[model samples]
Target: MKARKKISRRKHEVSTSNLIRHEVIGLRVTVVHSLNDKFIGISGTLIDESRNMFKLKCKDNVIRVIPKEVCIFKFELPDGDSVKVDGRMLNGRAEERIKMKRRKVVWPLIVEKQLKKARFQPEICEVLMFDP
Candidate 1:
């Protein structure tokens, strides 16, 4: 007998705090930074997403494929706030990432990236943030 994968019907709000668990295909996205200089400033409607790449339809009607790992993205929320996310946090397949119940590591990685620029030790930030 083949086991069926149960899908989640509960819709989680798409906020900066829980954006990783929502479907982001129709949202607007911009490549805020990338390893390749040529890919910077590419703003478009996100049409498709994969584990390691994003397919965007730009204003010129061109579909550009952007690598996720090396790029930082600024995503526009429905409420008009833009959230900058490190692509590494979205490293897994969509279904797997969304369905994850315990994301103990995601926050630390993102916070560490931000705190690194602010000259804070990542270990200290992690311990404080996850402290009971």
Candidate 2:
């Protein structure tokens, strides 16, 4: 006579992403900051791109930064509509995890073409006026 035993195992499944696998290449991006009632902005043209990373070429500066560091990024599409993405820069293990998490949805080939002919220029720089 033999006894029956049950085995426990977890099923691993991959997920399909809805966010576009495309990267912002050669596009212009601006980072703005408003801290302690002071506003500051930096402008640069994009050079390198990963899923969540970008390197920019400024007029007098070169910055290799992460998307999370930006307060806002304005990208002009070939279609003529400016796509503005707003977010905050995050550091430490959280940032590393976010980058790692995006690996599955990121495709290098998808971003190469879009950034080939991109050239960004700064068109706006102004401090917000307070009307009190």
Candidate 3:
């Protein structure tokens, strides 16, 4: 009898924080928040980007230039996680973002707070009932 060998698939890791440093052209993005009323709800594919602006190809095939300082962007990571980033945080050419100094933001604490306020409210209430 011949022994069968199992094939293992290699996992590809994607860094959520590095999205702004890489080529974002052709990626689908939504304007989650915008200081400009016209751009507040725009959703489109990013066709081009510069240090201060992004050219988005809308459904009507019209390209719109959005100022980076005035908007927040939402996009999906290759690993299926969705992230929202302030446009100001991503200011700079794609290449420059790699060399830029990133701010130290604690995410776990924020996520924990949100989790405690959601879905597990009953358990949280029980724990609170027995508080010191």
Candidate 4:
């Protein structure tokens, strides 16, 4: 009998790089900008999501549905890091988004970040060079 190697699973963490593939329900969200003036500056907990809209629990227990394409969302992570995302990039169902190929839109930014980190901290370069 052969001993099987156990696969280690990394817990999914949301970042600007993986915006479309992560679960976003229950995160604190804010509408930093919107095509409609009414939706600007609305902050709330995300209760639900659809292909084209988001349902949020706003102040005083009010629920509002805002179109995804018309607004820019700022999502606060559990670690207190905030990332702003454009709606156009996230235009698909959760399942579809996960299976879809990742766009290279953020690749340059990620390379820039790794380069900056490598410049400031030489030790990190060894780890980054081996990363896919």
Question: What residue pairs are clashing in model 1?
Answer: none
Question: In candidate 3, what are the lDDT values of residues 1-132, reduced to their tens digit?
Answer: 999897643222334555655567777888876545688789888899899999999999999999876567887666677667767666778787756556433335654565455443332121101001
Candidate 4, residues 29-57, lDDT tens digits: the string is: 98876656799899899998889889999
Q: Of models 2 and 3, which has the larger TM-score?
A: 3
- What is the per-residue lDDT of model 2 for residues 67-126, given as tens digits with 9 covering 90 to 100? 533244555544455544433222123335333433222224533343343331234323
Question: Which regions of candidate 3 deviate over 4 angstroms?
Answer: 1-14, 103-132
Give the lowest summed-lDDT range of ten residues in model 2: 11-20
Q: Which scores higher on TM-score, 3 or 4?
A: 4
Clashes of 2: 2
TM-score for all models, in order of appearance: 0.69, 0.38, 0.63, 0.68
What is the RMSD of candidate 1?
Answer: 8.4
Per candidate, the number of residue pairs that clash is 0, 2, 0, 0
Q: Residue pairs in steric clash, candidate 3?
A: none
Instruction: Encode model 1's per-residue lDDT on 1-132: one tens digit a residue.
Output: 899998764456577767776778888998876656799899999999888899999999999999977667888988898787767666678898777764454545765576556564333222111111
* Candidate 4: segments with Cα more than 4 A from true spot: 1-11, 103-132
